[model samples]
Target chain A: MEEKCTNVCQNHLTAVGDALYVIGGKWKLRIIIALKDGHNRFNDLQRTITGISAKVLSTELKDLEMNGFVKRTVHTGTPVIVEYELTGYSDTLHEVLSALGNWGTMHREKIRAER
Target chain B: MEEKCTNVCQNHLTAVGDALYVIGGKWKLRIIIALKDGHNRFNDLQRTITGISAKVLSTELKDLEMNGFVKRTVHTGTPVIVEYELTGYSDTLHEVLSALGNWGTMHREKIRAER
Candidate 1:
């Protein structure tokens, strides 16, 4: 029981860390930004966010779902389709990304001047 | 001359990418947050941000200076003193950090409940 308790505590810490790691992964932020235009099919996201490979998109989509940042819905039909949407948990990241983008635009001139 | 221009353009792109990489290093965000309290000496930064190694701090400080996020002033005296402060370019990141912090606190309870 003591060992079990210690394992549980350590697992919780690792889980939180892993959650951050998943969110912080390369392409994940871009993916979220891509999906912000409402529900998107897999191909839509892949096309919108330049420079992301297909394999990376698939992997990051699965990780985002696992971490509850996105919801994956499958439409059962002849071809079968999957769509992704921002979960409520992901709304805050929009503000974060907006700030990043704003900073990038505002600083580009000064940054170039510095160089 | 054409090759020189290509070299210049590609070098510029690579330089921008590398600057982002440096600012996004693991300890850099935490160090920036720590220094928000006011100007601080090297030891102050090292002490305030947990889990950062001395080597990592030194490396990050130098990177911050190179990227212009921080200004380093050296006070030459009996023992040379170094101080790090946020540059004007870095002021915008304070808004970014504040948003991140606010989101973290607001979501901590819900994130815990989700697990």
Candidate 2:
């Protein structure tokens, strides 16, 4: 029984740590949601997800793209257009996003109620 | 349609942000899992969740206690004992933890396959 419990807890700890590594940053989730909201242009994404500076946004975008959650394309034209979109792989995280969002919403209400 | 999406995405962003703000630290989730693993004392928690320094573990415990996710107790005897346990309220986050754990497991498999 003790061995079983230890194994289970160890798995949970490792799994949770892995999840945090992928989606744990301040701007990653917000940036993903903004793209889902149809913000494709660099400037548009910056505007939609407020308070994210250009340097930070660029770094995060690169990380997300590398992680396979985001797709970035450059259009060759008189003015080069760069767009960002969520890849289908990112949809796999729907459950995670929903879980976090739901808990956060409930927690906010609880905090406000106590206040 | 655009306005509606904006509102919905805004809510998701806010909710995700709130959730992350509470449980998003490097050690908080790991610490919570350690407590759930029945490692109630400080040294036990530090040992179970390896790599956490005494200072960081101390601070994270204080944050978790302040956020109402953990209960710290003291018992005076020949040698005073200190113990930590999850609060009933912390159970509310079972869904969040499960979602993250499941997703993380899947993600690990995916990465391994890609490699």
Candidate 3:
């Protein structure tokens, strides 16, 4: 019974691990962060976010939409524009990312000091 | 000159994006959260973490160590114990994960309410 319980627990952890694999990607966080400014289009996002390749950006956007962190709507007008917006799942990330941003600020300062 | 400036800026953003790739991963945040409890070992982490496979756990731990978020030490006294601890890089994650954990709690509550 104890062994069985351990196996079940391990299974649960693996599921969580799988979930994190989706959420814990490189551009996912930034794409969501950019969306926090409200709805943004593909070109705008590419322009605003410095280093994202068109391929990677497209991939991350699709992943974020699938994960429920973002919603993409195609506007039929004006060259069939597509825009992305944050979902409720993303509202939760705002605070978390803000905290991370603060950490990055401090981290960069520390690195500068070390140099 | 404008194109050159754009290239340099893009390079900076790419470097930052690369940094995020290392920081953002399935077990990286969880491992940091677990280590916040202070020193933990391979099996202990496997136990506390619910669902990580040994192969994945080993890989994540090695990556975190490489990224400076964790430090691994080997103890020679008894059975050659190995332990992992948070590094300065991880100290920053404490606040970020705390924010994330808080988000998870509220998120779960909302999910339950919907059900």
Question: Best candidate, TM-score-wise?
Answer: 2
Ranking by lDDT: 2, 3, 1
> What order do candidates take by DockQ, descending?
2, 3, 1
lDDT of each: 0.63, 0.88, 0.67
Model 2 Cα lDDT, one tens digit per residue, B1-115: 1233378988998998899889887789888888887988888888788688999999999999999999999999869989999999889888988998999999999999988
| lDDT tens digits, residue span B1-115, model 3 | 0112244334434444554565666677776656665428777777677667999999999999986788899999877979898877676666666665666556556656888
Question: How does model 3 score by TM-score?
Answer: 0.70
Q: CA shift at B8, candidate 2, in angstroms?
A: 0.3
lDDT of candidate 3 at residue B103, scale 0 to 100: 64
Better of 2 and 3 by DockQ: 2
- Evaluated at residue A93, the lDDT of candidate 1 is 73
Supply fnat for every model shown: 0.08, 0.71, 0.25
Q: What is the TM-score of each candidate against the true structure?
A: 0.72, 0.94, 0.70
What is candidate 3's fraction of native contacts? 0.25
Interface RMS for model 1: 10.7
